[model samples]
Target: MSTARILIKHGDVRYRLLKVEAASDGSLICLLDKDPQPLKGGIRVETGKLIAEADLEKPVPYGRFSIHTTGEIHRYSGGQRKDTIHIEPLHQLTKAHAVGYFSIPTPERLDTYDASKHTADVVETLEIPTEVSERLTFLLEIGPKALKVATYGIGLSYELYTLVSRSAAARLPEELAASFVEAAALTVFDSRQIQKDEAELRFYQKIYGQGSFVFRENGGAYVALTSVPMARAPTMRVEFDGSELSIETIPFDAQNKPTHKVRFWIRDKGGRNKQHDLREHIRSVVFDARL
Candidate 1:
């Protein structure tokens, strides 16, 4: 018993509805207040493929009948097409729906977008900035395993790299490793926006700069320092020599006075210090200490 307006368009021709009724077979018998004249070639349902065409030689007994869930109706003028009327369920047809349907161009075949081709087009068009492209290319050359270890050091879960890498491999551009690392870092750090602590913010900021990290070779691992200046006592300190990487945490009492301290060390594995192994060692130590 509810009344709704469904506006349908076929090229230059348009249909304004007076009311609609539900048929027994789940089709809609739309009653038109005014029908477009000269709808000669009849009404043909145009989905990805043609469904069926109805003859307009005799006026439709009711108004227009639609059995399709989604598509358009083409009203032809003799041998040539005249209008195209987009059709949707009464429950979905709205002013907004009509606008959105007309705004986007519908493809002839309803298929998934080609992401590889899109990426190739973007690269060929030189859409990415030169500096960003270079950095991403460098990250790609370093590989995903190394990037994952670095992300782990930055307090991301280990599985994050795998998830991002798999998705990027399937749908993203050629800079798969760079994309994975960037996505993982953004996901992890976005949550840190609520952090108000100055020192903690500075720590993450220093480690993540311009979507990349600055690391110096120390002991068996590439090391970075928190190095935030404190008014009373140092909030935290990370020190690395040729032998070990030491992280120290100082806790304060209720009076904001230094009470107790905790510290840990990741020892160098001598000549076995490949970048990945060193990074893994740092991640384990930091993760265990809850730093």
Candidate 2:
């Protein structure tokens, strides 16, 4: 028994092994096995080409066409083997389902096979939305783990800070408002830096105080509290160089100089670990009820 294969060109090119039921007068009808019900359609000769599956090693010659073992359909002219038909395989087909037809590429000899070049062609033919397709391609290449970390871990932290900042701007204590906003912004920045190093899911905690608010790092494992005078809020400056954590508080006085500066060095096994610790400490003081 011979298997039936159909070569189709309908805007997009597709070569698939379909169960062909009948072929006559340049028109063919096939029964789709994958569909729940049989699909019947008249495929004109101009739109499709049908070939019977046979022993590839034994070339089958029918009139002017010959199916060779190399999976090439060769044309005979004046009893001489003429041109070899070249079939391009669909690329990026796995990213999306082939709408009208099942996406399957015919086997070709190693020397003549190159599917990498047709990636753009396949993506264009699918007519998928550009943004959606790009995101899908990125997700496919980067894997789900990285996507989850980006969406949930880093992305969530940013959202939380934005929400807190907005709320703090309206209801936070007047003296601690500046400290709260600054801490929130710095926490968001540091969260992005150390999110990759963090192995477990930990959220920021809020601690309220009279003239200050503490953003507890990674659930209170590390703490850096930002404090100002009860009379007024001072400008706060924070710097972390992977090993040392520094915070300088400058009051709005006549000299306008830093009134208090505190620094802590976090020595660890590696620079990355030290940076991670410092980032956590900075992050811990970003959220508080007073803000």
Candidate 3:
């Protein structure tokens, strides 16, 4: 049986797990280490109602869903609590999971981080410069917090919004909040140390369900890029000089999901580029990508 230890902390925050074990059967358990009982494992910061990411692979008719995680249990759907599109997709990738910010332990990400320090603090202690750290911190923490505030409405989640909002505006920077609302977001997870260019595909999720992408860059944990949604405008907009591409599409299926596609291309003499080169370009821009 294989065993691992996970340390979790954030600037003297409430939780710091000295040992979080991942059992062989995929069931997780808090181990005999660090802090005290009620250490709070499910502290998820849902910025707002989840606009389900479209699972085009298994598109369900509107007003109905069969969630795969829960034994394919079919559940009725309703109109969105917020003014955003409610597409039915599976899973969301937030900094909370990437950095273990009050989330259940997942062995894959934790094993790659510093085994002796909290995931968040290890990110902080990387000495990656204050401005960059602040940007990353906001991306993983306050930025997501702000997104929740922008799309809140009075429904079953009214109390939740009120509770999170009490400290949302006071604690978040106005500019970062505004940026998240007005753009498509990209999160790049670097895995060079593990000897791979693309570690895994993170489901790119955003408020409006605009397309998102993830890949690794050097010298950082991850990077994000956000752009305004233009699902059917037919404009060929490009960012990151030329490594990244996003364009509107005149397409719709049964669920009215935006059929936009993102393409990554790097310039070359043969009008083609290798995947490694593309990874390098994005990594070089991680610390300086437009948010």
User: Largest TM-score belongs to which candidate?
Assistant: 3
**Tens digits of per-residue lDDT for model 2, 1-291:** 112322222223342212322111111122221222121221111122422222233322221333211112333322335334421111101121111111111111001212352221111111222232111110001111112322211111111111000111122233322210111000111112222101011111111323333332332223233343122222344434443544432233555322221223334453223225345444333322222
Candidate 2, position 129, lDDT:
29
In angstroms, the error of model 2 at 281 is 14
Q: Provide the clashing-pair count of each candidate structure.
A: 3, 5, 10
For model 1 the local lDDT of residue 163 reads 9
TM of each candidate vs. truth:
0.15, 0.15, 0.20
Best by lDDT: 1
RMSD after Cα superposition, model 2:
29.2
In candidate 2, stretches whose alpha carbon ends up further than 4 angstroms from where it belongs are: 1-159, 162-223, 226-261, 267-291
RMSD of each: 26.9, 29.2, 19.4
Model 2 TM: 0.15
The digit string of per-residue lDDT tens for model 3 on 1-291 reads 123332333333223222322221111222212322221111112463323333333322222111121011122222122111111121231222111111122211122333355432111111222232121211111112223433221111110111111111123333233211211122233211221111111123323244344333332122233333333422233344443422222343546432223233444445433334444334232111232
Error of 3 at 27 (Å): 23
User: Of models 2 and 3, which has the larger lDDT?
Assistant: 3
Give lDDT per model, in order: 0.26, 0.23, 0.24
For model 2, state the Cα shift of residue 126 in Å: 18
